[model samples]
Target: MPWGEIKDTAAERRMFQRRTLVMLGVAVLLLGVLIGRMYQLQVTEHDTYRTLSDKNRVQVQSVPPTRGLIYDRNGVLLAENRPVFSVTLVPERVAGMDATLEKLQQLLSISEEDLDRFRRRLREPRRPYQELPLRYDLTEGEIARLAVHRHELPGVEVAAELVRYYPHGELTAHALGYVGRINRQELQRIDPVNYAGSNYIGKTGIEAFYEEVLHGKVGYQHVETNARGRTLRVLERQNPVPGEDLQLHLDIRLQQLAHELLDGRRGAIVAIDPNTGGLLALASVPGFDANLFVTGIGVQAYRELRDSHDKPLFNRALGGQYPPASTVKPMMAIAALDSGVIGRHETIWDPGYFQLTKGGHRYRDWKRGGHGWVDLIKAVAESCDTYFYDVAVRMGVDVIHEYLDQFGFGRNDALDVRGARSGLLPSPDWKRGAHSQPWYPGDTVNMGIGQGFMLATPLQLATATAVIANDGVWRQPRLLKDVVGDTPLDEVLPKATRDNVILKNPDDWNFVTKSMIEVMHGRRGSARRASVGASYTMAGKSGTAQVFSLGQDEEYNAEEIEERLRDHALFVGFAPVVDPQIVVSVIIENGGGGSSAAAPVVRALFDAWLEGFADEETGAELAAAGSAGESSG
Candidate 1:
C-alpha cells in the first residue's frame, strides 16, 4: 500500500506542476501580444488612430446663409425667403431601410414620388453620417404625426429650412424669376467650393443675372457627435453673412396696374422711365405662379404649364418675337426724315395700295379707300401704309436696317434682366447669313412696313420707343435700381450709354414727335377713339400685322377671320409729347386692329400712370387755393 500510494501521489504532483506551467505561459504570451499592440497604436500609428477617433467624435458641417431679398422701387417685397419644414434622414444611422420606410409609410402618408426621391437620394455617394433631405414642405399634420411617434423613428428628423418665395406670385414671375432646388445640371454649373452648402439657385431673369449678389457666402460649424453619428451639440460656429438686398427699378403699383389692364388677354406691355433706364412696368399676361418652381414643380403641373395654349410659362415681354407692324412706323419715319428720303411737308399719293415697280406686288393700306395724298407728318399721324411703303423704297433697306439697328433693333439690348431676345433687323447680309438668300427690293418694301423678315421683341420695341422719347439718347434699360447694404450704388458700374442714330437736324426729331402727338390728338387719327378726354397727350402709332398673306386684290376682312388667324395688334407710344416721361410698347396676339385692341391697353396704362401725378397735382392745387382764399379773406 505504501509503495503504490507514493507513485500515485508523485504522478498527481507532476501533473499539477505541468498544468500550472501551461497556464502561466499562456498568460505571459497574451500580455506580450497586448503590450506590442498598444505600442503600435499609441506611438507608431498614433496619427491614424487619432484621426479615426476625431472623426467619430467631431464633425464639420456646412451652414447655408439666408438669401437676400428683392424689392420694387417703392419697397414692396418681390422675392423673399420663408421658413419651411422638411423631413431629413441619415442613411448610416437607419437600420433596415426598407423596413423603416414601410414603418414610416404606416405612420405617415407618403407618396410614391416621395419614396422615389428618397431612394434616389440614398443612392447618391454622400457621406454616410451626413443628413440628407428626404421630404420637403411637410404639412403641419405630417409634422405633428412625426413628432408624436418620433421615438419609434430612428435617423429621421424634422428640420426648419429657409425656402425661396415669390410674394407677388405670377405678377412678377418672369421679371423676378425664382429659386429652385439644385440639380445635377446646376451643380455642374455652380462653383463646387462655394456652393457646398447652397441647395437653391436662381434659374432666370434678374435672379440669374445677379446670382453672385443674391446668393450669400457659405458658412461652417464644428459639431459634436455621438456613437450613432447623430449631432450632439454645435461646438463652434461662424455666423453667415446674408446676401445683399436688391432694390429693383420696377414700380409695383404701375406693374400691378399694367397687369390688371392686360386682364385675361394674351399679350405683353413694357414701359420704361425715359429719364432713367428704369423699367416702370413689365407685364406679360397669362403668367404662371413662380412659387411652383421654387421647390420643384411636379411633372403634371410642369407639363400643363409647358403645354398650355396661352403659354403661361412663356415670357412674352422679353422673349416673344412678333412683327413690329406699324409700331415701327414712328422709327421708320424718323429714319426717313433723317435720311432725307422724305420731307416733313412733302406729300406722297397713296391710291389705296403701294405697287413695287420691279416685283409688281401691291402692298395695301389699313384704309382700303386710301388716305389719298399724305404728307410725311400726315403719313405718320395717320399711319398710312402706302406712304411708308413709298418712303421705305426711297430710303432703301440698308438705311432702314442701319437706323433701326442703332435703335436696339435686331440686337440684344443687354438689359439687366436675362433672356432678352434680339429682334430681327433684316438686311442683305442678314438674309445671306440666315437663309442663304439674296436681298430683293420686294423684301425691302415688306420690311419697310414692319412686315417680311422684320421681327421685334416687346422689349426691343419698348426700348426703341424710349430712345425716341429721350430724343435719341438711348439708355440701357435696367431692372435693378440699387443694391442695398454696405455695397454702394457706385459699386454697381454705371451702365454705358449707347448712341445709335443721332439726329443731324434736331428739327427732324421735333417734326416726328409732333406728328406722333397728332396720331392721338388729331381729328382724323387712327387712335382718335382712345384719345377721347385723355388728360395728357400721348404720341403713338398703331399697327396691324397680317396673320396670313393676302392676294394682290384681296382685302383684309378681320370680321370674317377666325380669332386665332386675325391680325396681331401693336402700338408704341410716349406720353406728354414734349417732356416724355413713360414710353410703352403693347402687343395683342390675334387682335384685329392696333387702335381697337392694343392702343386701348396703352391708353389705360397712360391713364393709370398719369392719374397718379394728376391726383398729386390736384391735391396740391386744392390745398394752395384753400390757403390763398383763407389769406384773402
Candidate 2:
C-alpha cells in the first residue's frame, strides 16, 4: 500500500524533458563549432589555402642564357652554340630516385657513366625543381623511346639546350679553350638564382678568363604543370640575354700555317701583330678536339687524352719553358750596347772556347773552331756564342735581369693568356733563395749562351721579339681583337702592364735591328738559307737548347742520341724589318738545329703573313687589325 502511494507522474515527466533538452544543447554546440571552423577555412584563410593549392600546379623555372659566339679576326666562327636533346630528371617529382634512374637506364640504354654522373649530380646542391641531366646529346632513336615511356616515368623528361661547339676543334683548342659540365665547387660559388639551370662553365684559356662576358644573364619563366611535374604551358616568360660575340685576334690562315709548319713535329709557334700586340697565331701541335669536352667527354676518351705520349692537352705555347738559347742574343745585344758593356765596334776574339779565368771551364762556342773577330753586329748575325759569353760576363746577371725584365722576360706579360707560366729568370738573389748557392761566374757565362738556369716560354720569346719589331715598345700580348657589343674592346681587356724600354741612344734600336737582319740576310747568318727567296726583308736569330748537357770534353752528335734527347731548335724574329707587321717565336722539341728546324718554320710564317697581308690596302688592314681592335658596335 505504501509503494503504490509513492508513484509521481510530474517528476517522471520533468526528468524526460530535462534529458531531451540536454542532448539538444550538446548537438547545437557541436554544430556551431563545425560551422565556425568551416567558415574560417573557406573565407578567413582563403588566400593561404589558394596559394598552397596553386604552388602544386604552378612552378617557377630558371632559363639558362645563351653562351656567346667566338669568332676569328676574319669573322670565321671558332666557337658557337648548337642545340641538343638531353635526358633530364627532377628528383622532387621523382618518387624513388634510384628506382626511377633504373627505369631510365633501361628505357634510354644509358651507360654506367651516365648513371654514375646522374647520381653524383643528384648528391650535389640543386634548386627545388631543377632538372638534373641523366644523358646528353640523346640520339633520335633514344628520344623516341623516351617519349613512348615518358608517361610511365613521372619525373623524367627530354630537354633541349644549346651546347658549346668548336668548328675548328683541333685547330683552335689551345687558343679558345673549352667549356664543360659545372662541378660542385663551381656550383657553390656561382649565383644560386642566376646559375640555377646553367650546367656548363668555362674550364680554361679564353673560355675561363672571359666567363662573365661569355655567359649572358639568366632569365626566368612561370609554368603550369600537371601532377607529374610535366609542363602544360608557360604562364609567363623572361628572355635571356645572349653572351657577347667576340672577334679574337687569331688569324685562322696563320693558325693553319703555323700548325702545318709544326706537322710531324712537337713544337709551338706564337705570332703577334707587332703594331698592336695582337696575337695572330698561337699554335701547339698534337692538339685535341675541344668539342669532345663540351658535353662531358667519355671516361675512356678523357683517359686517352690524359695519358697520351704527345701530351695534346698541354698548352705548349703558354706553358713550355725551354732555353731561349741564341734567340735571346738580340735582346742581350741591346742590353750590352745600352749598358755600355760593349762598344758597337768592340771585337771579341774566339778560338772556339772561353775560360772563366784562364783554365777554370772552357765554355765551348757553337762553332767548332772560332768566329775569328766578332763585333756586336757580327756576333749577333753569326750567333757567335763566344762573343755573347764575353758580353754576358762583362754585363753580369744584375744588368741582364734588369734589362730582360723590361723586355717581358721571366714573367707572363700576356693580357689575356690564361695559365701562362712565368718562366724562370735567374738572378743572384734568386740563386741564393732557390738553390742555396752563390751566383758563379760560370753561371754568368752559361747565361751568355741562354743555357744553365735561364728558361723562357714561346710567348715570352714572341713578346721579346715583338719589342724589337715594335721599336723598343713593350706592347703586352693579347687575344681579344674586337667585340660585337657596346663595350669597348680596350675597356673589356686588362690594362697592359708595360714598361716602355727606351734605350740610351735611340740609334741603338736601329743598330740592334740591323744586326738581327743580318741574322737572316747576311752571308754568315745562321738563318740565311731560310731567307734565300724572301720577297721582304726579315730578321731572325736561331738557337739550339740542349736537352742534355754535354760534358767538358763531350761533343754534340745529333745522330747518335735518341730523338727525344736531341737539342731543341728555337727561332725568334719579325718580318719586313721596317715597321714590322708580324713577330714570331718558334720552338721545335728535339729538332736538330735552330737554323735547320726552327728557322724554316719562322721563315714560312713570315712569308705567309707578309705575302698574304701584302696589297695596296695592306697598311690600312694592318692598322685596323693592329690598333687594339675596336668593337663593331
Candidate 3:
C-alpha cells in the first residue's frame, strides 16, 4: 500500500518463493519425462520403428520361372515361350477398387470378360499385396495410355511376362496340348508358394502330364518402391531356376506325313518305334490351333471348338475306339495256336459261311464263293471270317478274353499316355455285369473278328501290333524320350509298365509274323495290292468293321448306306519283318473297305518312312532282311 506500506512483506516473499519453486519443480519433471520418452523411441524401440519404415518403402516380390521348352526327337521346337506385356493391379494398394477398375477400363478399353475374370480372381484367396492380372497381351498404345495415367491410378502396373507358344499350331495340338490361365480349380490344386507369380498352367496332353517338370522353382527379390507402389529398382534378386527342357520321341516329319496321309478324312494314324516303344507320330485329323488356349481362349472360339461336329478338340489317336476287325486276326491266331485250339497247318472247310449246327444260322464270309479248304495261314491271308468263326465257337469266350487281355486289351495302363480310354473286351462276367446278359456262342464268333461288344482304341491297336512286332515282348508305349539336362529320364519319369506275353510255343510268334507277311505278299492276300513294288517286307492285316449289321440275305453296299453309317476301314502292320523298325495302325472312319482305303495309306506310310526318310544303309538292310525271310519261309 502506499505500495508496500500496508502489505505483509515476509508472508508475500515466502508465498512468492514457494510458487516459483513449485513451478520450477513441475518444469523439471516435465522435461525429464520428455527426455525419457525421446530415449525410448530413438534407442529402445529403434529397430522396430526402423523396420516399420523400411516396409513401407521396400517389398519382397516373387519372380516366376521360365517354362520349359518342348522339342521333338529331332530338336524341332514344339512349345516355347514368348515375351508379352500385361496390365495388373494390387487390391490392397488401391484406395477404391470399383473406382480404380472403372478408371482402368476407361483408360485401357477393358472388355467385360476382363472385368469378370478380374472380379472372379479378386474373390479368390491370395497373398497380401500380390498383383492380380486384369488384362493380358497389352498393345503398345494401351501401355502408353496406362503409363500416362499410372500416377493417378494407384496399384496399376504394366508387367512383362512369357506366355506359351506352339509353333506347329493346329498340327501338333492334340499331341503337345496347350497351356492356359490358372482357373479357380487349378488355383486350389497348385502349390501357392511355388506358383506365387505363375498365371498359366498346362491344360492337356504332354503339357498336362509333365506340368511338375515344366513348372520350375519360384524365386524372390527385394524391390525398392515409391509411394505410388511403382518399383524404382531391384534391391536384391534371387534368380529363378528354369524348368527342365523336354525332348519327346515325337518326330515332326513323321507327324506331318501322317497328317498328310489322313488329310480330308476323319481318321487317326498311330506310328510307333517297335524297338523302343516310342511314339514316332500320333495324328488326329482336323485338329484345332493350340495357341488359342495359351492366353485364355475367347468365348466364341472356344464355343466353336466345343460345338463343332468334326470334333477338332478330340484326341482321336488316343481316344477313338473302333473294332480292330481282321487287324486282330494275327493276335487271335497266336491265341488259337498257344491255346492248342488250332495248329498252324490246321485246315477248315469254308462253304462261304460258318454254322454252329448242321442247319443253323449262317455267319457269312466276305468272299461270296468261300476260300475253299483254308488253313490258318490261308485264313489269315484271305481274311476268311468262317475259319475264325469256327475256331471262336470251339475255343469259347473265356479263352479269347484271357488271350486278348494279355495283349493289352480292356485297359489303358501305359505310363505316359494320359486320358486313354480302355476299350471293352467282352466276357461272360463282363456281359453279365455290363448288359445283364450271358455270353453267347454267337458273341464269341463276333469277338473272333473284333466285332460285337469288342472295341479297341487306335493306340491299343498300335501298341498290340508293336507287341507282335517285338515278338511278344511288351514294352509300354511312351512319348517321353529324354530329359534335356543332367537328370536321367528314369529318375524323372515313372518306369514303363512292361511284361512279356508268354506263349506255349515261342515259335508261334514266328508263325503269326510269317503269316502276316503273306497277307502282304501272297497271291490271294487281302492286302496284297497295297504291297505292290515294295522293296521292304511289310507284315499287315486289313479289316472292315460294320457300322450296322446287314440282313441275312442283304449284301453291304456303300452306295445304299449313309456316309457315317458305312464300315470303318482298319489296317495294322510292321515293316522289315525280320527286324521291325516301325509299327503302324490306321483307322479310316466310314471308309468302305480296309484293303482299299486304309491299307494303301499304311503302305504310303511305309514308303515315306522306309524309303523317303530312311538312309540308304537302312533301306538296304531291310531289303536284305526281307529277301532272307522270304527265302527261309
Scored by TM-score, the top model is: 3
lDDT of 3 by residue, 67-98 (tens): 99999999999999999899988898899999
Q: Which stretches of candidate 1 lie over 4 Å from their true place?
A: 1-48, 120-131, 489-497, 613-633
Model 3: residue 545 alpha-carbon error in angstroms: 1.5
Clashes of each: 0, 0, 0
Q: For model 2, state the Cα shift of residue 259 in Å.
A: 0.9
Roughly what TM-score does model 1 have, to 2 decimal places? 0.89
Candidate scoring better on TM-score of 2 and 3: 3
Q: Order of candidates by lDDT, top first? A: 2, 3, 1
Global lDDT of each candidate: 0.81, 0.86, 0.85
lDDT of 2 at 558: 72
Ranked by TM-score, top first? 3, 2, 1
| Regions of candidate 2 where Cα sits further than 4 Å from its true position | 1-35, 613-633
Whole-model lDDT, model 2: 0.86
Q: Write candidate 1's Cα lDDT for 482-515 as tens digits.
A: 9988888666635665765588797777778888
* 284-384: candidate 2 lDDT, tens digit per residue: 98899999998878899999999998899999999999988988998999999999999999898989889878767888887778879889898888888
After superposition, the stretches of candidate 3 with alpha carbons farther than 4 Å from their true spots are 1-5, 8-17, 613-633
Candidate 3 to truth, TM: 0.94
Error of 3 at 87 (Å): 1.6
Model 1 steric clash pairs? none
